[model samples]
Target chain A: MLIRELERLENLLQPWREFEYINREVFRTLSPVQVEFPLVNLWKNEDKVVVTTEMPGVESEGVEINVTGKTITLRFERKPEELKDGEAYTRRERRYGEFKRTIELPFNVQSDKVEAKFSKGILYIELPRAEAEKPRKITVKSE
Target chain B: MAETVKDKNRENRKIYAPAVDIIETTNNILLFADMPGVNEKTVDVTVEKNLLTIHGMIEPTIDDKLTLVFSEYGSGDYQRVFSLTDEIDKNNIKATVRNGVLKLVLPKTEKIKTRKIEVSGEA
Candidate 1:
């Protein structure tokens, strides 16, 4: 009797499973796979290098930043929006998932001194050049 | 149904059509738009007649003193338009911006029957 009841429940859920499959196919066709997420911009001055990336609707706690020598890695996860019963999405274009990106800087940075700030869903990171890596200026005196 | 319309005003800065998700319930519609770097003061939403428009202005990240060494994306403003129908109560629309995302709630107008018509049989 238990086996027969489980089979009946499965039959009832068959249509919902097919609907989920169709939904996945529709989303795949609308948006293609991208190699990178949260694309970044890098800026440099004499003192430090600044990196910025836009990640709207993401919490600061979900982001992880790591710096090793001249390389920096960013890892983050965007949580999916939840829907209540009877609510349906008419159109969807936002992308959400776990993303990881590694970037190489021009020179070694002060890993311990790196400063990062999140404001208005934009991540700003300032990596100061290591004291030993920066070029030193020397003066010459003629007698 | 919502349809996008082109804006007549053109500026030097590039304007992007921000990605949006539209959800519908029995009583109202919800819209979420991603416009990074835009805050409440910089974002604007207006409804005129049957048209609704959204605009968000973002400041440039780089200045003259700094050289952009590497970039994978371009900076721009956000603008999108949608044609609304009479079903939506435009006067009661509510909007908010948080974490660079805009959320809009459009309430559905109440259905009203102005008059009842009677049918008569003809000879």
Candidate 2:
């Protein structure tokens, strides 16, 4: 119970720390900066692992994927969308910036045979299971 | 696993509000919506009685065979509405959906007439 309370307090303190950091940076450079990361989903089975991420406004050329051992790293750079001169914006919710996401796999995967596909703003990656990670059945010797 | 069993009504899928950016220019307005799981065939944009609505359907996430390891974003249909004003030329508006992003270009005014001027002193 005490650990949970501490965690709650930490979560509440994070925003204030970020606010202070932003203010300090704003004083140094008369400009503001913001960043956002896309959401990710992972699904795994006996033979393969599938990873999906939502990355709207990211061009196909701006995505980079690297797999080393049981971890995968994704980097994205999306161009900031702009409006013409004299235009007014009514509502703005989507954000544009550069971000990176790295996640460890549940198990070791075959890095050489990994495949990635991008469609409709979603990035789908399929990683085959390593031979050692695949399930094996053992036979018993008869007495 | 618990999220699916709690709601058995398949037709009552949750409606999500898609992230969008609305920008205006002197001659037109541009709307960009993030709908990553939707394709052109699955998206519908309609304007009725000055009410503009955008709808996109995404595949359900509940699967019997595949086991979920980790998830961050919710999966469902996206629906959003905006009121149109007289400044917009609805007839010339065009929209395109690619890679789950929808871009709608709303022109500011109607077509302008071109007048041919001839000078008497011109050869």
Candidate 2 regions off by >4 Å? A1-36, B1-10, B60-64, B110-123
- The true-versus-predicted C-alpha distance at residue A22 of model 2, in Å, is 24
Fraction of native Cα contacts kept in each candidate?
0.75, 0.73
Q: What does TM-score give for chain A of every model? A: 0.75, 0.70
Top lDDT prediction, candidate number: 1
Tens-place lDDT per residue, model 1, B3-113, is 222232235566666778888876778889999999999899988777688899887766678899988777878877787878788899999998989999998777621
- Summed backbone clashes in each candidate are 0, 4
Error of 1 at B39 (Å): 0.8
lDDT of 1 at B104: 94
Flag clash pairs in model 2: A87-B24, A120-B99, A120-B100, A121-B99
For model 1, what is the error of residue B104's alpha carbon versus the real structure, in angstroms, after optimal superposition? 0.5
lDDT of each: 0.81, 0.76
